[model samples]
Target: MSMAKDKELVLSHISLEVRKLIKMYAAVNECTQVEMLERIVLEWNAQQSRTERPPGDEDE
Candidate 1:
């Protein structure tokens, strides 16, 4: 297939995977998909921010 077709296929697969993940998390956590996604994004952002800091920067 052409490069455009390949990109579309990859995006489609990613979309499906995201939907499945949302459904699974919502069912397991007893929360709406949006709530679960919000929590996940917040945690991810916190982790990323922490990683960007220097080693001795964390307070006890």
Candidate 2:
């Protein structure tokens, strides 16, 4: 398989429960496991962004 030069592959050891959850979500939505994982990551990023403030962004 070929990947974009700007991208790099990552490896992680995930728990069995999380793996099963990803498979079930992918199957129900008819999407690939990778897509489900990406969705999960995006949601996590958004949640963190909302909770954290950037430098110099303190409340007035």
Candidate 3:
């Protein structure tokens, strides 16, 4: 599968339970496993952005 150049291909080992969950989520969402994984990562990034503060933004 082709992805944008900004993205990097990841090859990591996951637990069987995690793999099954991803498969189920992909099937329910009608998306490929890769898309589901991307959705998960994007959601995590958004969540972190909401709670994290940048340098110099803190009150003295």
Candidate 4:
């Protein structure tokens, strides 16, 4: 399975403070900002997948 086919490009807006924070975190972690954002998003997705869903929500 190619994940490239499952992904979509997105544009987002964030406050300057948040942008600066991301940049600093990326620098400290020795990664580009884009990689840092992807890591955060992938971790969130993993967390969501591990969460239990409410009854009758299986179709989603």
Candidate 5:
């Protein structure tokens, strides 16, 4: 699927409960919702990259 379509599919699958949780966490952490989401996405991407890297790769 195209990137835009994938993004839409992902967004559509998110439940209201999860959305509320994200908002609550953002509020409790004193950060904007978008900032919190960006941090989460970055962290997840980093983790995926690390896992996909070679075992001997220390640069990760």
Candidate 6:
């Protein structure tokens, strides 16, 4: 496994309700909670890339 995959990131100070929601989503989707979060982040990044590109910023 890569070092990045082995390292942990903490979502500190999040509410109990939010944590429960993540757990429930992971359970229903048959993925680990971290996987669910990673999927969400990946989707968010994709969407941001689509709408966030500058119109005249292409490189030659």
> Using lDDT as the measure, which candidate wins?
3
lDDT of 2 at 33: 66
For model 6, the superposed segments whose C-alpha errors exceed 4 Å read: 1-8, 55-60
Reference-based lDDT, each prediction: 0.69, 0.68, 0.70, 0.65, 0.69, 0.68
After superposition, candidate 1 runs with Cα above 4 Å error: 1-14
Per-residue CA lDDT of model 6 for 1-60, tens digit only, reads 122353244333446787688779899999877776666668888888878889987557
Query: Each model's RMSD to truth, in Å?
Result: 8.8, 5.6, 5.5, 6.2, 4.7, 4.4
Error of 2 at 50 (Å): 0.6
**Which digits, one per residue and each the tens of the lDDT, describe model 5 over residues 1-60?**
123335445544668887678688899999865566666777888899889988787863
Query: Which sections of candidate 4 miss by over 4 Å?
Result: 1-12, 53-60
**Residue 57 Cα positional deviation in candidate 5, in Å, after optimal superposition:** 1.0
**Model 1, span 1-60: residue lDDT tens:** 123335445435547779689769889999866566667767888899989999889878
TM-scores, all candidates, are 0.70, 0.65, 0.67, 0.60, 0.68, 0.63
Would you list the rank order by TM-score, best first?
A: 1, 5, 3, 2, 6, 4
- Among the numbered candidates, top TM-score falls to 1
Decoy 3 TM-score against native = 0.67
TM-score of 1: 0.70
- Candidates 1 and 5: which is better by TM-score? 1
Q: Quote the positional error of residue 32 for candidate 5 in Å.
A: 1.3
Which pairs clash in model 4?
none
How well is each residue in 1-60 modelled by candidate 3, as lDDT tens digits? 333333423413556687689889999999876678778878888789767978768556
User: Clashing pairs in model 6?
Assistant: none
Q: How far is candidate 5 from the true structure (C-alpha RMSD, Å)?
A: 4.7
Cα miss at 28, model 3 (Å)? Answer: 0.4
Worst 10 residues of 4 by lDDT: 2-11
